[model samples]
Target: MKQHLKRTAEYRISNRRMSKSGIASLSHFLYIRQNSLFDIRCWTFDVRRSLISFSILPG
Candidate 1:
């Protein structure tokens, strides 16, 4: 019974530590994802605007 209790306590401590790190990494991943998506949106918008300008100039 004592060994079982000790093992459970150790497991709980490790789980808590892992959860904190997991949350940090998950948030970091989301931040990077959001920035990349924003960059892609701006790039596409710029490309479309330049294409429109070029087409207008030719006509």
Candidate 2:
């Protein structure tokens, strides 16, 4: 009975640690995703601006 209780306590502790790390990793992924989206938006805007300038220029 005592061994079973000890094992149960250890399991709960490990579960909490695992969940905390999981949250941290999820937030990290979201941060990277947001940065990538921002970079894509900037790149697209630059491309559009260059295209417009090229069209405006005389041959």
Candidate 3:
């Protein structure tokens, strides 16, 4: 009975570790995506500003 309990406890610990790792990976992916989205937003804003400036200037 004691050995069974020990094995169960070990399994639980390993399962928890695996879940934590999965969460870490998910958060890392989200971080990367957030940064890329920010970059895209900045790039678009710059393009819009340049377009406006070009329109205002004489051809």
Any residue pairs clashing in model 1, and if so which?
Answer: none
lDDT winner: 1
Q: What is the lDDT of residue 19 in candidate 2?
A: 100
**lDDT of residue 3 for candidate 1:** 100
Cα lDDT over the full model 2: 0.98
Q: TM-scores for all candidates?
A: 0.71, 0.84, 0.70
Cα-based lDDT at residue 4, candidate 3: 100
Candidate 3 backbone clash number: 0
Off by over 4 Å in 1: 1-10
lDDT ranking of the models:
1, 3, 2
lDDT of the candidates, in the order given: 1.00, 0.98, 0.99
Per residue, candidate 3 scores C-alpha lDDT tens digits across 1-59 of 99999999999999999999999999999999999999999999999999999999976
lDDT (tens digit, per residue) of candidate 1 on 1-59: 99999999999999999999999999999999999999999999999999999999989
Residue 3 lDDT (model 3): 100
Question: What is the RMSD of candidate 3?
Answer: 2.0
Highest TM-score model number: 2
